[model samples]
Target chain A: MKSSRGLRLGTTLFSFTNEFHARQYSTEQLILKVAELGLGPGLEIVGFQSFRDYPEISDKFAEDLKELLSSCKLEPSCLAINADINIGKDRTLTVDELVVYHEAQIRAAAKLGFPVARCQFAAGPEVIRRLVPLAERLNVKLGLEIHAPEAVDSPLVLSYREMYVKVNSPYLGFIPDFGASAKALPPSFLAHFRKEGVPEKIVCVAEEVWATAEGNFGARLSEYHRRARQTGAAEADIHKLNMLFAMLSKQKPSAWIEIMPQVVHVHGKFYEFDKDGNEAAISYAELLPVFRDGGYKGFISSEWEGTAFTDDNGFEAVQAHHALCRRILARA
Target chain B: MLQTKLIAENGLRATSTGFDVEVRLPWYRGLPLSTVEIGDVVLNGEAINPASVSIEVNGKTRLPGDLATLYDERWYVLDSAMLHVSHSELKRGEQYDVAVSVNLRPPYIPGLTWAVKDAKRLTANS
Candidate 1:
């Protein structure tokens, strides 16, 4: 039965990073592939990766993109923008300079017909506050990506929330990456390390540490290092293990309820699917209901990051993820 | 790290001064040149002098060490920076072992620098 939920499915081209870097598909071709594969009625793109001259869209490019999307029957979900506050080698970008940088990209996003521009938090609430007027004028929402290593109540996000309350603008919000609420480290991620010669004993210990270890990230890092060293793990392997802490989040899924109203978009982050077609790392079973219950009427961009660890083309991974979401939402 | 994809396929070519091997940014997004640090270039088990190695991208060329302050130049994700070694030992149609390392310090991700290394054996083209 078709569910009446406002949630919609889509794909971000970041999922095809491997194919794009391998020169197998151009930006246009990837968009077409997403349409052909039934991966989207909604599409998202990272500006720098998809455009030759980002933050500066030509009239020709804009017209062509609009036509392409019209013909392909796809909606421009969000434009992922970079807030390069540290572009300078010797000094970080000042708030005014950062605003200028972000303004150009936000204008480009508006021109290209993206309703939302996914932003980074490198720039503080001051920079975001400075951009709010432009965002309101252009009707483009700036959604800060709450990726791994950060959660809804994280200090930085909490600061943004404080600002949001004072401002009270619908244009300012969060884009939660489900990876930040993962239930386990991706199995493929661990398997890749093992294949690289990390000992099985060390892998098991790392898994245990990831699952049951308490304390803040720094304390956990020290503990994992101490334990892995006891198992004779190489320094290189231990260094690789650091990604577990950085990429996968330990935040509980229910934590998302705190900011669900401010969520303008969702990064449906997934690494691998088990034989039963469930995500191996993140618990979509636990995440989807939060959005459903919280009245999130936005696009959930299926972001497959499996290509980061494996050579898979990721087409099937996105397909599987979409299927899983549909199955879960059918019962939501 | 996508280290294997760091070296472009069949990208070794003999230049007027020496030979140029095409090296790519392993990251998914384009970054300013200021953030990229080009490291060692070794051939046939002999490491080239660091001063003799230069990277050419976006129509401009700079020595490996000079890239640290070049904030204006950008390395497109799809593009490759040519590692030009000013040596006369390379010959056309000869297979040689090539190794390259590059470090990326993304400004947003504080206190993290991703190191990528690749070694490929390919015949040089004149």
Candidate 2:
């Protein structure tokens, strides 16, 4: 997984979790299986629920696990930690709670000798800024994942980047989920318009009406929903999505770089693949060029999350993506 | 006589001669409807013209199709609550020999007014 100048390739282990359901493989066996991926320089173990039940990680503890990665000839890219910020439940936390809950994970990551502990953007900017000093002192960077359906061109993203620059801390970085990158609207959308049974004239009129209305993002989205429903244009939904993704790739270059310095890990996701072993859901041909050109030499974890959860062709899909990704990285 | 379970996907439109009814209404989200014709014009059911109102007399089976059309079609006139032209008024429990066609659209938020007209009525007491 190296470039022309030896840029190493690594990915998350979450993608292959389903594969080892065979023969009741242990976590060490899974790590060995991940190393077998021939894909990773390592694996970022996800902690977002019952993943901790694996025996190898539970047996040796963090130090042993750290030693084991080296022993297995693989690197520990990151720890998938769960911090209970509960942004919806409570907006503000006292400084002590912030340290106890938030800063503890950063310190723990440092203690475990990992460079990063990914944090959820649960609270607002004030919280993120407050924790930066603690993260810097712990010598462990915090990478907030920019995930999907939440586009990079999203106001939330713009606001996050603006806040990051204003705060200007080295400890704060981002892991822009490549899945989100793939989740975009394509540029060529006239065919979609036709599928929705909506004439361009109707959409044009609706857009005109929407502008003057006090339509926020939700309102605009609902209005679009209404139009699609009105014109019975379900097929137009895909075209609309393609248009959104294209918008993201085009607009988020600065945002990408702004958060890139902090990107310790990334979730490279896929939805569909083709016969020649290319992802059909998105044009990685277009996006991979941007990631390489943008100097994003980081972990592109194959987060195999989609309808694949129900597919009999489980990790086979992941393998194709891995080969496809290797090809992309080689070109990069 | 031919019939199909269809929908007015484009919704109902009002025109001078007849209405362009996209047969999509209610649960029939994406069904295709047969083009119904009576006169030279295509018999699209969503005609929103300033037509007549149904009295007790129009409800009888003896009334013709054009009268039945006027009876079933509903339009919102300026300042009037809404224009409802129908031959029969069948209450919930009062069983009567009734035959009619109704095409409905899911309540959609208009890009203009934020009025939840159909949705309001549908979910009002529920």
Candidate 3:
């Protein structure tokens, strides 16, 4: 039952930000841990954040990093890069300046042997278009992250799809984060809400509205507000509910097939894993089949985001996530 | 992730004029140091004097009271800016809770912003 499509498992060092900050693991140790866990042959890195001397990596440092990865049997998969439009107070980066910034990161990614560089939404079509030639020349793919709150049919995403069709280039693609396909609100958010004294009845009301609300996001939000108010939910509770609505999307897992071919990398975004080794929030059971059927041949890095909500150890969470992925992929 | 590290290996003496602390800024594309405003430095719930703050970068020190104008170059990646704070209240071998408020220039998207208005406590090593 192995997937005919080549969907390799991997992970990003971001999962262990808490551990890194706690001094429990150095960057090299984290890479070795990933390898030791058998979680990856593919490793994605946030270049600036992960490296000690970022934006100024010496040749010796680069060589040392390469040697470490080689020794650990890990391959550089993607280099997550930032595109900060804000240059100064009220001074934003021009398109030309953005091109220069991204080009430099792309070159760095290439030099580090990463095949892909993930960019943020701030890198608009203009900036991405400008970087296409450089990416092509460097033999690296520039992937724009399609994270949560952005649906599959969003106008901005569709515009990128149109550009891809028009340009017909392999260098431009999407890195769909599984957060968009999440079926339930993150359990940690619920725990916080309840800890803040939000009534369970009110929480149920919010969940019902989220599951059944219709029309556009704005319309659905308004409907949720009206319904929650009728239930005598406090203003603070209502505000928290609104924030939850904004965080989780209502997109179906099968909807990803629309952009499947353009997916260069996948962020296997997860919150918590159950005792049964399943994601508590996201519906990966339904999502992986779409990739398998659509013939996606890329790395889906297990990105454990639970640290944002809880002090749950990322190393343990990622182990559960990869185990879940292996079970699902075996059935596919 | 943003972090603060005290550079004094011997720990701050009670009679010392000031001590050096390195503030590791979050990784972003590129931000001009001029736009970064470091607000009050709070130590164990007490606020430090703003006038006594000086910043050092690349071996050059600037005490213009404005962080944006202090640094000669902009910041990109996960870079740490050295901050030198002058105060007379620090005690030797004391673990003081340290916190600093920072406001970076807002990116084009309203959501991609960084600000610390409330003091977030950090554990200091003696």
Candidate 4:
């Protein structure tokens, strides 16, 4: 029997976004809760969400975080930082400015004892390529997230792959979010839309288009828009559901093997758990095997995004996700 | 969008010219004040003039129209800002149906602006 591989389970503090926003838990309390619930060994946090003045970590804050992590016995897995290209209202930041912006966060991540910093795709090849030396110097791996609407073989992803080949730095890589390879749109997603005053008929139309539309993501979205508009869906309702196209995708789970070697971290994105405790939309059964077989020896942060659509605190959902992943990995 | 939580309870307070309503940031993360657009405020079905409105956040107050230029100021996610509306008719202890709409142009997502609005009955305080 194959033993459990290097793939380990962890939780991103983002799973508690609702509780954090609702002021139910402070930052330090969230970390302690992760340990209290037996959810750690790896912890991920969005820099902007967790820190009051992010991209500029004060020495005091960094020292406090390091001490807290040591006491809780949790490892800092990744720091989710944004590349705010359009930070200025008049125009997007130039490549030089963008490079400087990312460097600060990367340095901050390094200071906080994180091995990886997950950057957004807003940093193009030029920005990424420029940051390679900094990443190498700081010993931080810059993993650009391959989120939904783009997959392992998407054209833009392909361009990044090409650039990675030329740059040939071990520090530059990918962080595959499992949401990019969803099996189906979760029923809760539709139900949440319905609860938000979106017409049931429109939600049903979105479900249908998600399952049957042929072509690229943009084409499929346009088709859904055209069809939903024809059903007399209001512009506001249509706009509400527009995010569905970007939050979930239809890529094959096996496609992950293409970039597994370069994957520095993983966002084990889940929406809900079924009666059997399996993830409702994302298939950890299929996804976990890819990482295991591909030799992805990194932290799979259990990122529960259901809080975006529901009022749940998501502690239970995250526990269920971790349990499911553990069960699956044990089988291997 | 957390519309129900956008407006705070007992958040209305009387100002010299009008009243201030406490409003929460709808997005998950804190953002620059400049990217925020205070769209419209309908008080008791009457639309408040946009030019006369200002927002107090991050320890400073600025007119809604000038928010686009205040890029350095931030609206922290946990703090609720006061939307100061210059209306003369709001009376202390009176309850009014107030509707507020705010839009955020996330700097990362080009050409897309996310909007959130909430309508709640709030009692004005002196």
* Proportion of true contacts reproduced by candidate 4: 0.49
Off by over 4 Å in 1: A199-201, A232-234
Q: Give chain A TM for each model in order.
A: 0.95, 0.71, 0.91, 0.97
Q: Model 1 — TM-score against the truth? A: 0.96
Model 1, DockQ value? 0.65
On TM-score, who's better, 1 or 2? Answer: 1
TM-score, candidate 4, first chain: 0.97
Interface RMSD of each: 1.7, 22.0, 4.5, 1.6
Candidates 1 and 4, the one with greater DockQ: 1
Q: If you assessed candidate 4 against the hidden native complex, which CAPRI class would it receive?
A: medium
CA deviation > 4 Å runs, candidate 3: A53-58, A193-247, B1-15, B18-36, B43-49, B55-65, B69-99, B104-109, B117-126
State the DockQ, from 0 to 1, for candidate 2: 0.01
Best by DockQ: 1
Question: Residue-wise lDDT of candidate 3 within A204-260, one digit each (tens)?
Answer: 777787778866567777888788788887876776666566567768999989888
Per-residue lDDT tens digits for candidate 4, residues A253-331, read 9999989899999999999988998888888999899898889898999998887778876788889888898889888
lDDT of 3 at A148: 64
Tens-place lDDT digits, model 1, residues A73-136: 9999999998787774575778888899899999999999999999887878988888999999
Q: CA lDDT, every prediction?
A: 0.87, 0.46, 0.74, 0.87
How accurately is candidate 3 docked according to DockQ? 0.27
